[model samples]
Every structure is written in C-alpha cells, then in structure tokens.
Target: MLTKTVHSSTDAYTNFTRKEWASLAYQASVSLTDEERTQLQGINETVSPDEVEEIYVPLTELLYMHTKHSVNLHNDQNRFFHRETKKVPFVIGIAGSVSVGKSTTARLIQALISRWPNHPKVDLVTTDGFLYPNHVLEERGLMKRKGFPESYDIRKLIRFLSDIKSGRKSTEAPMYSHLTYDVLKERTQHVEEPDVVIVEGINVLQVNKKDRRISPVFVSDFFDFSIYVDAEEENIIKWYVDRFKVLQNTAFQDPNSFFHRYRHLSKSEAEDVALSIWKTINGVNLEKNIRPTRHRADLILTKGEGHRVEQVEVKKS
Candidate 1:
C-alpha cells in the first residue's frame, strides 16, 4: 500500500514512498544497461543504472499495463460507435521546471518501456522542438521568455499531437538543437507510427483553464498518462546554475554555440548571471505556468537532494 500525508486541504492523490512504488514492478528484471543510462543523461543530469532498476523499471511496467488497458478501452469505444478506428499511440507526458530532469526521465521511460514484451516501439520527443524559432521569438520580443508558454508555437504543437492521435502513419516533429539553441531550419524529426510516445517539456500540462468552454482541446488532452517531476525551488536553482557552469565549460565554448558569450565569463560572473536568470525568468515562469499544472498530472515524482526521487503520488482512478 502507498503512504500518504494528506491534510484536510489535500483531496486528490494517494502518495507513495519510493519503496512502495518500486514494489509495483513485482521484481522485474533490470533491462536498462549502463551505456543506455549514459545516453539518457543530460548536462549535469546523471541517472544511474541502479536508479533505473529501482525507480524506472517499475514505472515503465505500470505504464505498459496502462497502455494495454488504454488500447482495450479505445477498441471498446470504437465498437460502441460502430466504426473501425485504429488505436492511437499511448502518449506519456513528463512535465517539470527547467533543470528538474524531466528530459532524462522521458528518455529512460522510452528505453525501459521498449524492453517490455512484444518489444513495442517507443518514440521520445521533447517539446523544446515545439518552441518558436529564434527569429520568431526575436520578432515578438519574447527572447527573454524563451521557455515560457508564449514562446511556443501552440498551433503547430496541437497539429502534431492531433496527427498522432488521429493515427496518422507519419508526421514530422521539428527538432531543437541545444548547441544552436534554435529550431533547425532544414531538419525535422519524423514521428513514425509507434506503440508509445513520451513527450518531455516544462509546459506539457499547461492547459487553458479559463477558456475551456471555448477551447475544443488542450495540449495535455492527448496524454494517456502524465508525470510531473518536482523538487524544491532551491534544489532546482542549484541544478540550473550547475548546468549553466557545465555548459560554459562545454557547449558554450563552441564557436557556433548560441551561448558562446557565456564561455568567456569568469566563474563568479557566470554564477551571478545564472542566479539572476533563474530568479527573474525561470522562477517566475514556474510560479505562473508550470507549477499550476502539477495537479493535472496522473503521477508526481518529488525529488530530494542529489536529484533522487524521494516520493511518488498517484491520483485515484
């Protein structure tokens, strides 16, 4: 059974400790390798193989179970309608603030879920791809709010999801390059028909709550399941600053890097700038856009120091 600390004010999710959620895996074998974990790590974001065995293995098993049930439900609905509609891909959305490690979580999900029986195909796409191109952001004077909701091309993102949910055999999803810090003008990632799709982004769960009556669908409407990766603001700030420093030593040193100017900054100067950006941009965006959607997720993974998931909370079915 899960352990929860609910007060009179809390009404929805039944919280689970890491151990309790791990038990749901029924002791499944660890199929993810160290090399795979290495591939999944983002800058300053490291996911150990042990964490995969303990945390992600069970999570993916549960998701696979959910996918099977979702397929059956889709079939049942089709039967009721007297139509032969094909089952859509099971979409798993991972949402959180910048530097909260949702991208690595999404990649691990794709890797682990693909190892399940039938070796079902899974495609992981980051919604950074859905952000408006640099020129577009510049034209709109939204360069400072690059990761905020207003910086995204929502119509394009909605159409992309609509295509997959409508069972289109193929659709193109644009790719965002961290090195260039822009959407590649000539490149696009193809979302071929797949069994599962894992989408990671800060705004994946942000829905239009005020205009729901007029809006036909929100971006999160396509998700079969959603996980919100969360941590204390202080921890996320540290991670963001640490990542910025790492980027300064690595990607920012490249002549073609969009952040090349940062590579020349002294250590203290870099730290100051990182903290300032977090305080002004990322922090404010979190309060206004990201954190508000936490309750909309099916599961919440709260992290402790050292970026470990300390607890899991699942909303009642």
Candidate 2:
C-alpha cells in the first residue's frame, strides 16, 4: 500500500519522501532506460537517472494503468465498442506554472510511455494549438494574456478533445507557431488513433470560467490521468527570467520571431522584462487559476529549489 504523511500546516496534503514516492511510482508501471537517463541529464540541471526512475517512471506506469482500465471499462460497458472499433485514446493532462518544466515533463512522459509495449502508439499535443489566433487575440485586445484561459477557444478545444475521446478515426488540431506566436490559419495537424494522448499546458485543469454552462465540460473531465508539476512561486519566477534570457539570446534574435525586439535588450533589461511579464501575466494566472487546481490532480510532483522533484503527492482513489 502507498504511504503518506502530512508535511505542514500550510500544505496539509499528504506528502511522500522522494524515495518512497519513487518506489510507489515503480509499482504503478514505468520502465526507465539508460538512453532516457542520458537525455534527462542534459535538460535537468541536477536531477539524476535514479530520480527519474523513482519519480517519473512510476508516474507513467500509473497513467498507463489508468488508461488500460478506462479502455477496458468503456469496452465492457458498451459491447458495441469492441476491439474492432478504435479504442478511446487515454487522455492525460499536465498542468503547471510557466517555466516550471511542465512541457518537458509532458514530452518526457510521451516518449517514455510510447516505449511501453502495451502503448506503442502515443501522441503528444500541447494546448498551445488551442490558443486563439494572434489576430483574434489582438482584435480582442487580449494578446498580452496569451496563455490565460480566456485566450483559448475553449469550446472548440472541448469539441476537438471530445471527438478524439469518442474514438474518431481521425481528428485535427490547429497548429500554432511559437516563433511568430500565432495560429497558422491554413494548417492543421491530423491526429490518428493512438493508444495515448498527452495534453500539456499552463491551465489544463482550470474549471472556473464566465461561461457557466460550458464550464461543466472543463478540460479535466477529458483526462484519464492528470499531473501537476509544482514549485515555489519565487523559483518559477527565477526560471522564467533565466529561460527568457536564453531565448532572447537565441530564438528571439530571429527576424521572424515575435519577440525579436527583446533580443536587443541588455541582460539586465531583458531580465526586467521577463520578470515583469511573469509577475503581471503568468504569476497572476498561477495564483488565480492554476495553483488552486493542484488538489484536483491525481498526482503532484513537488519540486525543490533546483527544480528537482523533492516530494510527491498521490491522491488515494
């Protein structure tokens, strides 16, 4: 049985020491490879393969089990939905603060889970594709809050996810351009039937919206499993500033980049801009939206000062 202890008054939620959490994760069903260990080293500053094995490996396994159980339940309940019919894809949601490495976690899980023999066909999709087109956001004067929940076409995104979960033979999601920070009008990426689908974004689990009727169909309803990567707000701010500086020196230098002008700023100036954006936009979104949903997640990976997952919290079913 999994064991947990309450850590503090501020966070009464049950927490597991990293080692205990890692062991439980293995019980849930993930395998780690040496190649993945090598790859993880390059992205994570101080994390080791042992850490991944203990944390992410078990998390992925739990997700695979959840997916398998969901598919079985669906097939058994609806006799007509047999193996011949496409199996409903297992939908997983990853949510976290900006620059907290939620995207990296999603990508890593996608790669890891796909290697599982039982789930060979895995596809990863980001909620970035669901964001309103730049023109639309600009017209609505909401361009600055691009990652805010309101910036998304929630209705269309719900419909798209519903279609995929219904086992549609094929579906398409709008493609968004990171370089230009806009939706590509004429392009869409087709999603074939897959064993798993990962949906990653900053606010993948938020249920509160002004549209009360559609709010009932919140994104969390579509997830078979969900993960929330967590860290101190201050740490996330530091990460955002550091990553912004890196991008400003590289990607933002591109003429076609939407943030190209930021490349001209001095290091201190760039840091100020990054911190300002984080404080005004991403930070507000986290406080008002994302962080509250942490309790709703099936699993939570709590990070330390270095962004290494130091503890984990798994909800008891």
User: Pick by lDDT: which candidate is best?
Assistant: 1
User: Candidate 1's residue-wise lDDT over 1-317, tens digit each?
Assistant: 21332312136888888888777776567567677778888877678766787788888877877988997898899999999987889998899999998988888888878778778889988899889999999999999999988888877888899899999999999999999999988899998999898888998998755443435678899999999999888888889999999999999999999999889899999999999999889988988999888888998988888788888888888
Tens-digit per-residue lDDT, 237-305, candidate 2: 778888888889888999999999898999889989998898789888888888888888888888877
Cα TM-score of candidate 1: 0.93
* Pairs with steric clashes in candidate 2: 22-54, 25-58, 29-61
TM-score of 2: 0.88
Off by over 4 Å in 1: 1-9, 78-83, 209-216
Model 2 per-residue lDDT at 262: 90
Clashing pairs in 1: none
Tell me, by TM-score, which candidate is best. Answer: 1
